[model samples]
Target: MRYLTGYSEAVRAQMQAIHARQGLGRLLLARYPAPHGMRTDRALHAFVTELKTEHLRRAPPIDKVLYDSKLQVVQHALGLHTAISRKQGARLKASREIRIASVFKDVPHDFLQMIVVHELAHLKERDHDRAFYQLCESMEPRYHQLELDLRLYLTHLEATGERLWSGSGSSGAHAGADPQPAAGGRL
Candidate 1:
């Protein structure tokens, strides 16, 4: 699948077999049955801030954290971390923001956490190098497994156009919602 380009042919074939049997969604649901109820932008901001506080306390502060409908999963931009500069009188201020794709709003908590951990890692290591992955793993012990599962979820979505999780507290209510105002804070 396009989402699994980095995986080996054998792994891809295994995934294909799972898809052939329509077990992708079942496998994911068995692993993660519930969604983490951080639905609103305010909630997302708090969730991200807590993680940042616990892991990267010395890194640059995050000015905003919200679900962005503009991010397309096909492009591999599940989440983004940006530093925006502004001129506050004579001094230039840099504001860091993290935007997660709306599709993640309906996924498992571990999937969302993996994406946030990746973006949070950017606060220190800018590139996707060894140090960046090390930071991600430090923040979440199951980082790699969650990432692979997320990719599998994306592959299943791209193939069937069906969502495995959808209901109250886990629906797509905020999937295309507008970006809320910055939840300004420093940890």
Candidate 2:
């Protein structure tokens, strides 16, 4: 199970309750990619390096990166919609800290890269307006369709309770592992 580290115990308990009641644990586990035998540090670093490269290519420098292992639960997404500005594909440098969802640990490289592209776009455009989507489209073609597909994929995973990717079937699960801290970055 993924733990929401750093959050209040009460909030964490509340999250646990919500996830249990909704059967989110089973849903997420069933759909989440199984744990890979490789070291999370090595794999996550490689992935982030690629993401950072793409981020530097068209977007401004990212200040700090924060990812939640439990963010995949979807139920924990409450209140963030109001407190934090929602950007479909972009945000400005002046904008507040950004939060993103990884959904599954062993996600496809292309799909994960696509999401990084989406968040990087946010660093440029802070809304889902035409211009914002235009920028996203420029960064990633078929932006509209890709967004729809991604949402649909998540929805389908939820509906059918199927795993996204297969991995080593070790009992030690890493589907929701926290991001490892890098020199100037955190997983």
Candidate 3:
């Protein structure tokens, strides 16, 4: 339905079947594994910092990074970037802040990376046109795929009233981390 609008009919049918299953939550949990616990503001700041260092080295530094519970995904966003200007003595200075949805605290690492890369790209390109997406891809090569997967994830959440990784930490298809106890596979 609402979340599947961008997908083709065939894809929607398949996903709907998945959604209609007795324990869609279990299926999703099997796929996504566990949510991450970059729960603290400091941890989030460090995480964003690493992404910036890896991809946007020449871009302006971010003054702050936070995971805000006030950010709701159904509102059509997973992250936000803001430019703030202030008066310092006689001059005006600017800084940027990035806020990710607190809901991301428990998703897979790749999804977090996608959101971080997206917000970071805004520092360079202010529009959601071709150039902005190009920049996003430059930052994360698998950007498009991860984004689609994340959308499917959101669809699952909306349909099931479930949190995919409601239990422990991230341990999924992502390579580095060891597999966690299933929310029962690796989203």
Candidate 4:
């Protein structure tokens, strides 16, 4: 979906033309190479390792992780809320399994890892509470800090209309994706 970034004049012009043609703005874009000095990537990898070793107890086999360049809704951390029902599973001859889905179209790696670790934790802890936070924290010591950072970044994007997280806005801004209050964000 062509996501827009208010970075360059060209980006805005393209967004304008696309918006003029189509009623809705574009959202997803292809995966561009990771930027130089992507310390975030290293941090994210460490976070994932922590999740595997400390929090999850056992590592859940990841089936597939696709980093789509095109997807709207900014960063919809989609995943199986719960395992498939027994009846449905029997119908599909599938095991009672849960899944995780995250969109990196425009999300930073650290933020993306936060969302992923959050979802993966759900596989172990069904409810969000002390146990959940404990698990999340065990994996990522600065769990709340990272979350706040991501929220601030999103607020910045909303205020300036510049794409947040990803330089290439493949997915357009997602609605209600940001739960944190945007105190200084746009009206």
Candidate 5:
């Protein structure tokens, strides 16, 4: 329920009913079924790059993309996008990076894509406004649904402390135990 703060009372009640019956895990597992295979930073970079190329072709180039074990879900930061500028000799160079929480390493591909799409949307729209959401939808048609499902999954995890999906690529770590932050900690 903490993860579903913005949802309506009805929705919260529905989730509560499911949790009371201990069916949140079952619902999430039925919907997601499997975790994705992009476990390493290199593979994550490739995955993000492909998504960027397909959706934000004209956006700034991304210098890095990786799963950060230090990003805690309790902090409400599932993914982060950062742009850093440094004086490179006689000129300034900017590098963009996206960091996904390591908890996502054990989630479904749709959940991963939803977070990635969110970070990728930041490349063009800096604020979570209508334009930003429109951009997200452009990239992933099921963006809103996936986001709601991800929140539900987080709610399930918070309530039961059980992971619905785990496999070879999963870190199998609890989301709240990781407390460090990436540079500039802005979600």
Candidate 6:
């Protein structure tokens, strides 16, 4: 219920629909395949970089991108986009960075794309205004849907304490709510 909290009635209804589907017969995630070939930070960077090159060509380049273990989805922050600016002597040096919750490592690629695009959009737009959302939509056409479905995925995780897609692999990995991998990540 906490995971489903903060959502509107319509979204909660949608989540119930998905939950019913998950319960009546099979897990809803079965219908959505997990992302493959991106289990490591390096692979994830390459994936994000490709997306950046494709849509946000003129946006500021990302200085750092990593799967942060400290990013807990329970706090409602699936991803973070930050510009660390510090003045050294007379010039201000800033680095744009993106941090994705490690919980997403096992989610579907659509969900991952949604979060990544959301963060990437921050490079150009600081606020979640019209232009910010427009940029998110431009990067990921199904941004809203994927976000809702991702919420459903989190709700499922909360209710069942099962990760539909586990770290070992989608086929054989047993479900575990916490799949905390290593701390240090490759760029």
Instruction: Look at candidate 1 and give me any clashing residue pairs.
Output: none
Tens-place lDDT per residue, model 5, 134-163, is 888899988777777777777677765677
Model 3 RMSD, rounded to 1 decimal: 8.2
Cα miss at 58, model 1 (Å)?
0.3
Tens digit of per-residue lDDT, candidate 3, span 101-168: 87788788888888888889989988776788788888888777666567667666665455567554
lDDT scores of the candidates, listed in order: 0.76, 0.44, 0.70, 0.45, 0.77, 0.67
What are the clash counts of all predictions, listed in order? 0, 8, 6, 11, 0, 0
lDDT of candidate model 3 versus the reference: 0.70
Give candidate 6's error at residue 146 in angstroms. Answer: 0.6
Model 3 ranges with Cα > 4 A deviation = 22-27, 73-76, 168-187
Over 95-174, each residue of candidate 2 has an lDDT whose tens digit, in order, gives: 23333443435544444545555555566666645666566567667554434333334433444455445533222212
Off by over 4 Å in 5: 73-76, 167-187
Error of 3 at 174 (Å): 25
Which residue runs does candidate 2 get wrong by more than 4 Å?
A: 1-59, 73-99, 167-187
lDDT of 4 at 166: 48
The TM-score of candidate 5 is 0.87
TM-score against native, each model: 0.86, 0.48, 0.80, 0.50, 0.87, 0.78
lDDT ranking from best candidate downward: 5, 1, 3, 6, 4, 2
Decide which is better by lDDT, 1 or 6. 1
Q: Which prediction has the highest lDDT against the true structure?
A: 5
lDDT tens digits, residue span 1-187, model 4: 1222322455346445544564221222122123223234344345445555665666554333333332234345333333443356447432333232333335555566666667667767877667876777777666665554444344344444555344554333543222332122220
The deviation in Å at residue 21 for candidate 3 is: 2.7
Candidate 1 wrong stretches, greater than 4 Å = 73-76, 167-187
